[model samples]
Target: MFFEGFSLVTQDVQGVRYRFRSGGTAPDAIFLLHGRPETHVMWHRVGPLLARYYTVICPDLHPERSPEQQVNDLLTLATITGHDKFVIVGQDYGAHLGYLTAATAPDRVQALVLMEALPAATHEGRDDMAFSLAQYNSCWFAQLHPKPESHTIPVPAEWLEKPLPAESVFAPEAVADYLSASIWQHARTVTWAAACHPIRCPVLVLWAASGRIGGWYDPVRRWCDVTSAPTEGHAINGLHFLAEEAPGDVETAISLFLEHCIPE
Candidate 1:
C-alpha cells in the first residue's frame, strides 16, 4: 500500500530500522526529512509535487542521532538506492540533519534546502540571540519531563494550536505516528560537533516570516551569516509548518534554487 503516492518501505541499516517512502522513475533524487513531533508523513503534499520531476524519498529519521550517525544512515540509504549524489530538503528539526549532511559530506550532496530550522552552530543553552526559550521550548519541555524517553510526553493541544493552527490540516495517521515515535532517545538540545564545519554546496534557506522564529534574532539572516557556502534565503507567510501551510512557496523556492545547482 502507498502512503500518499509513494510506497511505504523500511530498511535495516547500520543496526537501525529506518522507515521511509520513495517513488518516481526519474534518475535525479530528492530526500525529505521531517521535524520533531512529526514523521516523514509531514511531507505528504510537497513530496509528491516534487516527485513529478525527480524521485522523492521521505524518511522518518531519528533526529536524536548525532550528526555523524545521521549522516551515515543517510549515505547508507542512498547507497541502497544506487545514488551517490542527491538534493536534500529538510524542515524544522529535519533542517538540523540537513546542515550536518551538507557540512559533513559535501561531496555526496548536490544541493541543500533548509526551512524554519537553525544551523548546527554552537549554542550554550543561554538566552542570547543564538538561542531562544520558545525556539528550543520542546527540548526544555523534554528536560522537565520525569521520563523524557518513555514516550509518555503529553501533547499540549492548546499550546501547539498557535504554531499548528486548526487550519494546518495534519493527517490522523501522521499525527499518530509522530506521537508514537520516541522523540528522546538522545539528550535534549544536544549541540552539534565542537567545530561547526562549512557546507561546500549551494544552500537555500526558506523561512516563515510570520515573526514566530525571529522574535529575538532573525533566524533567516542568522542562517545566511553562519554558512560559508553560497547561500540565499526567502521569507514566506505561514506558521512553522511551511510545507503544510505554503507548499507552493516551498516548491517555487526549491525549484528555482535547484535550477542553478543542477543546471541541465
Candidate 2:
C-alpha cells in the first residue's frame, strides 16, 4: 500500500501511458523504479519514509522496454513534473534503468542507487548471451503467460514473510500492463551489453549475496571495480528481492550513500 494522501496518476508520455504514485513536499526529487513481477508498490516501505526528505516518484515500468527506452520514459516523467534533476533508486529491473539513465544523462541525475541488480557493464564489455538464453527459457511461459486469461502472477509464499496473492503485488492495471509489455528476454541482455557507457555520476550499488542471482554475472567484481564514477558497493545478505527481504539493509545503505556520498 502507498503512503496516505499520496496521489496515483497516469500520464501519457509519447502515446504510452505511465502510472506512478507521488506525494512529498521536499524540493529535491527521488524516483523509484521497481523490478520484475512487481510495480511501484514495492517501494511502500521506503518510499513513504524517503518522501519525508525528498519528492518520491515511483513508476510502474513494463519489463518489455530496453534500457534506453526506460531512460526516455523516466526523462519524460521528469520533464512533466518539472524536475530538471533528481536522485534515482531502483531494484532488479528498475536498477537497470537507474544505471542506464545515469550513464546516458549525467547532468540530469543528482545521484543513482542500484540494489541487487545486474552489475553495470564497464568498457571491457561482457558475454552474457547464454545467461540471457537461460532467462528466456525460464520466463518463456511468462511472456506467453496471458494467452487465455490475464491476472497478476501469484507471488510464491516463500518470497515473502506472509503469503499474498500475485494480484496483491501491484494494481490490476499494472499487472495487465506488465503482462502486455513482457517480451524478448535475450534482446534486453544485448541492450545491456551495449549500454556499457562510462558513468560520470555518484553511484551506490547494493549487491545481494552471490547465490541469489545469475551464476554467470559476477555482481561483486564489476560492481566493486566500476571506475565510471565514485561507486560504493555494499553487500546485502538476502534474496534477489532486495526491498522485500532486506528493507532495513537497503534503507541503511541508501542512508549512508545519501549522507556521505552525495550532498543534500
Candidate 3:
C-alpha cells in the first residue's frame, strides 16, 4: 500500500532491461531519479504525493553505465512512456544525472528539481579539505578499479542516522529495495564529469539545512553560474536525504516551484 495506485513496469531500452514504477493519471509527467545507495524506492514517500498532480516515473539507475548512457536511457524512457516533456526531480547522484539530462535535452525537460546536489564541475572545482574529509568514502570508492558489492549493497545505518523526528525511520521494505540493486560502480561511473552545457529550463535547488552542502557552498549562486534560466533555492529541515527525512517539506517546495515555473 505504500505506492497505493502505482504499478511496476519493466521495459527494454537499447538492449538493456529497465524497471520502474509508474502511477498517477495527469497529462504532465515527472521523472524521479534516486541517489547513491538508493534505488527508485528512495522516493517512496514523495512519489505518491507528486502523483496526485503528475504521472510519476521512478527508475532504478544502472551503476555500470556511463552518465551519458544513463541520461539517454532516461530520455528514451520518457519517449516510450508517451511523454514529450517532463519534470525531473533528482537527489544527490541522481541530481547530477538530472542536471546532465536537462543540459543534454533542454527542450524535453520542462523543469528541474535538484536536491542535495551541485553540478559535477562545481563539485570537482570545490573539492577541498572539508569535502575530502566528509566524502572520504566516496573519494575512495571512485578510485577502486572493481568496486565490491558487499560494501555497496548494505545501507549504512549512519546514513539514516538516529535522532530523526519521531517515527521518521526509513521503512524496511524501502531499505530492502535499495539493497537489491547493484550500486557497486555508481561512484566511479557517475560522480566525476566534465562541465555540461548550460541548462535552459527553470531550476530549483534544494538542500538539507543541516547538511554539508549548505555549509560547504552557496547552492543558489553556484547553480546560477551553470543555468541560464532562473534559479531558486531552498533549505529543507533535515539532513542529506531530504525526500525521506522531510517529505512534506520537499513536496511543498516542489509543488510551489512547479506551480510558478511550469504552466499547465
Candidate 4:
C-alpha cells in the first residue's frame, strides 16, 4: 500500500504501545485514529487521499482498551514521528480518543473529524444507537464472546451498496478485520464506557442512511448538546462503513472540512 510510506515505528508513551502508518512529508500532519478490532486499514481509502495533500498518519488504537492506554500509545507514536501538532480524525472508538487527546492537550489537535462516532457518553450519545431485541442480543453475544468471530456472507464487496434495512451491518472484510485485529472486545466495550464524557473540538457527526446499529438522529443531536464544540451532522448515503462504501463522498466531505483547518 502506498499509504504505508512511513516506516513501522514503535512508540512507548505512558506505557501504551502505538503502531502507525504514515505517508507524505512535511510538518502539517493529519492523524488517523481507527476504531475497534481494526488496524490503520480502516482508513485505506481516506488516508492515501489525504496523503496526497498533507502528511497522513493512521494509527490503530486497540479500542477494546482504555482511552488512557490508547492515548499513551498515540503520544508515544507522535513522539517517535516527531509530530508536536496535528489534526486528529477519529471513527467510532477512534473518535473518542480524538476528543480525549484534544481535551487533554488542546495544543496538539488543530481540528477533529468524528465519523459515525460520538463523545464518550453512555446515557445517550450520538454514536450510541438504540438497538432492537435481535440487534441487542447479537451485541450481547459479541461482548460475551470477548473475541472476534467470522461472519459468512455473500457478495461481501457489494454489501454496502445494498439499500437500507440491511439484514447484517457487517461485511466480510469488516468481519475479518475485526476478528484479526488486536483488542477487539476490549475496544468495543471501552468505547461505549468512554462515551459518558464530553469532548471539546471542531466535531462533525456523520449519520448512516440506514442505521443498523441503533436509532440515528437523536443521538447525534444529544452528542452536540453535551459537547460545546462546533458540531454538525451529515447523513451519508451508505451503511456504517461509509468510507469504503462511499469513498468519493467521504473524501469530498473530509477535504472540505480539512480546508478550513489547513488551507491549500
lDDT by residue for model 3 (1-264), tens: 687789999999888899899999999999999987788988888999999998999998876888888889999999999999999999988888898899899889999999998776766757776576576356446555665333442456544554433464577677666656676444454455644577888999999999888988899998887778999987998878888888889999999999987785
Candidate 1 structure quality by residue, lDDT tens digits, 202-241: 8888887774554445665667666777888778787677
Task: Please rank every candidate by lDDT, starting with the best.
Answer: 3, 1, 2, 4
Residues 1-264, candidate 2, lDDT per residue (tens digit)? 535557889999777788888979788888999876667877767777777777888887755656667689889899899899988998877887787788787888878888777664552446455444454334444456563134333443333433335534333443344445433232345345534567777888776674345355556456656545777666777656667656677777786778765564
Q: After superposition, how far is residue 46 of candidate 2 from its true place, in Å?
A: 1.4
Per-candidate TM-scores read 0.81, 0.73, 0.87, 0.73
Against the true structure, whose TM-score is highest?
Answer: 3
Q: List the residue pairs that clash in candidate 4.
A: 63-187, 64-186, 64-187, 120-194, 120-195, 120-196, 120-197, 121-195, 121-196, 126-219
Off by over 4 Å in 2: 120-190, 214-220, 224-226
Angstrom error at residue 250, model 2: 1.4
Weakest ten-residue segment in model 1 by summed lDDT: 151-160
The local distance difference test score of model 1 is: 0.74
